[model samples]
Target: MDSISQLPDALLLGVLSLLPAKDVVATMILSKRWQFLWMFVPKLIYDDNYQNIEFERLSRFVYRSLLLHEAPVIETLHFIIRPKSNVVDIGVWTRTAVKRCVRELIIEMDCSSSSTAPVMLPRSLYSGCSILVKLKLKKVVLVDVTSPFSFPSLKELSLKSVKYPDEEFVQSLLSNCPVLESLVVKQCPNDNATIFTVKNSSLKSLVLENQDLRYNDIGAGYVIDAPSLEKFKIRDLHEDRFCVIENEMPNIVEADIDVAYGHPGKILSSITSVKHLTLCITSSKDAYPVGLAFCSLVYLEIWTLDTEWSNDLNLLMCVLRDSPNLRALKLEQLDCDGDRSCWMEPSSAPECVIWSLETLELVDYEGAEEEKKVIAFILRNANCLKKATISTESTDPNKRLEMLKELELFPRRSPNCQLAFYYSP
Candidate 1:
């Protein structure tokens, strides 16, 4: 009884459709022609870790494995259940995987530390799947569905820890997902999606995470226009919310602005055609007004959470004097305000440190003396610099050799500049 069990039967159901639907129903005890061959296995995954089971014996083993799944065409149906799972057995396993035509439907019914009751997303999966192309939901609950919501070949959507019944029912479920294109909204500790309007034009990658504005109610906000966006991310949106930008996104390149406590409002001049920007804030009102022209900036990242090092080095010298084609710079100092005092250099210099800066990175470096005078004013004015990396938070040994001999006596003006240091624990 070998010869690889006499392969065939569509090459053993394509190797049991790469297992895991309880290991392809435990190969039905490998006999009787592998018994019903896991009913033509076609990718049916049920990730169960239901914390100490017994939900009626896991809903009678998912109703006898969907009555021995016959698989006509269900490309992928990943259901992650737990936390009191059993909304009528997830509406009879999402109406039997949308009547066997599912094409990527990932459901995460986490119930968030259950008290059960919160699993209503089975209106025949919005009109019996018109070939769904990817939908991901978490913590489930999206009622108020009226019909006419046709997905028409959806294209990647993710709503984490969801619970919508308003905000125009999440803007009529994102204007009926007509050709969606990668979207992710993560908020849930019983999140109630407060006014998150995204005007998708076949969207192009967006991610908005965590919204808990002390239970917003007085002028809540969040809005985007998505003129065919090109990757955007926003986090926290600290308090006085009212962030709206229902237009202007001339095909953004890449942005990851984090607003944890203040100012990030005008959507940072509507992502002036961003080119890899990441600015985390705590205040310094997100300085960016050197006539706001990041004309397709080139990689700049600065994060500051517990400020005061002269307001994150004056917001990193006003985002390197407004990113004039910035080449590469990453500076991060989340917290450590003993205020050792120093940063008083920028009285000019900074057109990307005198001509398209070239790669510099400092993270959590606390040589203080204002981070060794901002790394000796970027190795004495970048001049098309070529690689400077410091990583210290000084675990003293004479303070990391007095910050590598005070930044190697800073003079450098890039004749192929190069310097390095480490020690971040």
Candidate 2:
């Protein structure tokens, strides 16, 4: 303690910055050197769950700490409010943070207990925070602002289970961020946006998750028009939910498409430029464009559902036929239940399997006859394969040894290909 106390004030403050607000303030009682060090910590995180303080006391501490904080710039201000907390006090705290020139601000309300309504953020936060770089709000209500508003320097924005005023507000808010780079929106029921549209030119990554189970039949959908997107992810397993890409993402390098929609032809066609793709679908028929070619694809991951293995294999073959440059392939089955589906080999091998594929992984392998046949087909066709790994779902030693011996006996087209096996359980 004596040696640490002799360190420079800057070093001490740096250490304090990593601690939460409660702990930072508690350090004042250590010694005279630490009495005022907490005041200069640039980042403050106030989470009610950390301490057992009453709501009123927590509010007072936050108000007092912000008042005494002497930092020149608040690099980050994070607040996690509990259910049934006072909204008026939260507004004041946010306004104070905005006044302190906070670069990154996060306000998340606990919505687990449905006893309180979503907190409506202060209007000053909308118009005053011009220099904010990143803003994330969860389980809050965004009120409409009649005055001019824009986050000129904001780059990353995430809205998780947030309530917007209307659909126009959603589009307007996104359009106002001129230089935004990343956006994540997790939708909930009655998010006030029937058709969520994102039309940003500067965005490089986008993630959209639709959890609105009650509104699938109402024609609710998404429209994305981000031309510069490099990474894209969408997960909508609900039935009948649709997505429309306004333009092809020529710059996309990675993509994850997990959907149960009947027609995904348009979605698959727009991401052909992707180099790494993760695909999950419930049906195989018309899941993607008939002739769509992923010319730049180097890595592919396919997630198999509990449905028929034939449908999954058909989709796998279709994708492999188009991805001629794919070097690595991973197949993961979600479960090991139900009767094994019969495996029927295609008349011809995919170009990727014959030439480009180097690595193959089979996850949750049940060692059934159908699985063995599928593995044998790949081993026989993949001439350039270097390594193949099979992770079995069974933990029985006899079954595992039997499976390993059977796999080892399969003929490998590539003389150098190494076969590895393991029990996952």
Candidate 3:
């Protein structure tokens, strides 16, 4: 026998641990010794994105594999099953994994069909899986818990396309995770719950992404009250009524907010302590709250949907004025359509614009009169500026050259500043 085939049982099992559950089971054909070596592997991953195999055969194979595995404590159990999979088999498989003391469980189920009801996890998962440290479920329905439950060891929990029984169940689920530090929820319009309030003190990172705003004035909202949160991100693709940040996060280091239409103040006010911030706002008029100061901000990126750039010009000026210690600035125009007739300079330049700003980046630069004026204004005032990069959407070589010439003629306040241009074809 070869040296590899003659390896020790423990080493052989270690090799098999990296293979998918299907491939591990196929090792039965290699040799008698290799047949049961895979049974001792600690991690089992099953993915049913195959084309030739029939669903009935796949189901039987999964059940047989689970029954034959000889591992004492399963470290990881992952299943990526299609929506057409049998719910009863999934439940049985999950129960078996829980019985074997699974430490990490991930289930990604496709629910695009919408014809099948969301799969209900076994109750044993909540009450019995004491060793679980990470749990991620997609397109699963979480039923209301009648009895008390807690995941004492869970540290990471992600629910995407998940349907909750009610608002109370979600609260109960989060409250039970004593050590959970990272939580992610990507909810859709059909998720049934219009409002989700996360109020965990132990959470450090939170992400809330809501898609497909049903109506222009849908009364959807989120309430976050995590005091220890350090990284926060929220994206509402369409219009929502409002978002409430009940507690001011003192330890927030990073925040990324994108709201198509809503009260922008609720988001800006919550991240005053953040060092890195990205704001993507789309409103008919400027909506940023006044007197907000980003005392800790060092990097700032702004994306506006105003075609004229005048709708949010005042808000932009306020942000520049508030971030006195900012070192980098990035501006991108989302919907560049109208003329530059609406552009007007602020009464006075911000302190950061004159002294602290070092790097400036502009995207979707169309070489309009207002864009030229803004570029000139920054180059003429920013004494500490080191580099400025401008990327335009125009593909024509002649237009790019013309825009570059126009920008090069603008006077520079800092002799050390370098200019760079990029053209998107």
Q: What are the lDDT scores of the predictions, listed in order?
A: 0.77, 0.88, 0.83
Give a tens-digit lDDT track for model 2, residues 1-425. 87999999889888887888999999999999889989999889998777667889899999999999999888899999986789999989999999998999999987767664788898888888888999999988898989978999999999998899999999889999999999999988877987999999999999999856665746888999999999999999776879999997999999999888888768999999999999888776657578899999999999967467776777888899999999999998844457756667899999999999999999998776677777899999999999999998786899889888889999999999999898887
Q: Please give, for residues 140-211, the per-residue lDDT of candidate 3 as tens digits.
A: 877676888889999899999888888888888899998999999988556767778898999999998886
TM-score of each model, paired residue for residue: 0.33, 0.96, 0.92
Model 3's C-alpha root-mean-square deviation from the true structure amounts to 2.4
141, model 1: CA deviation in Å? 12
For model 2, how many clashes? 0
**What C-alpha lDDT does candidate 2 achieve relative to the native structure?**
0.88
Query: 328, model 1: CA deviation in Å?
Result: 6.6
Instruction: Name the 10 consecutive residues with the lowest summed lDDT in model 2.
Output: 334-343
Off by over 4 Å in 1: 1-82, 89-108, 111-120, 124-136, 139-148, 151-182, 185-200, 204-227, 232-250, 253-273, 278-295, 298-324, 331-353, 356-361, 364-391, 412-425
Q: Which stretches of candidate 3 lie over 4 Å from their true place?
A: 1-18, 111-116, 215-218, 284-286, 339-341
What does each candidate score in C-alpha RMSD? 18.2, 1.6, 2.4
Best by TM-score: 2
By TM-score, the better pick of 1 and 2 is 2
Cα lDDT of model 1 by residue, 1-425, tens digit: 56767888888877877766777887878888888888778777776663455667767876788776887777888887875766877888888778778888898865546465567876778888888899898878877766676788989989986888777777777778878989998766445666678777898999988665555554566788778889998887556656688789888899898875455647778888889998887766544454677867889888876446676777778767877888988888646666534457767887877798888898978765666677777878888989889887667789788878878888888889888888878
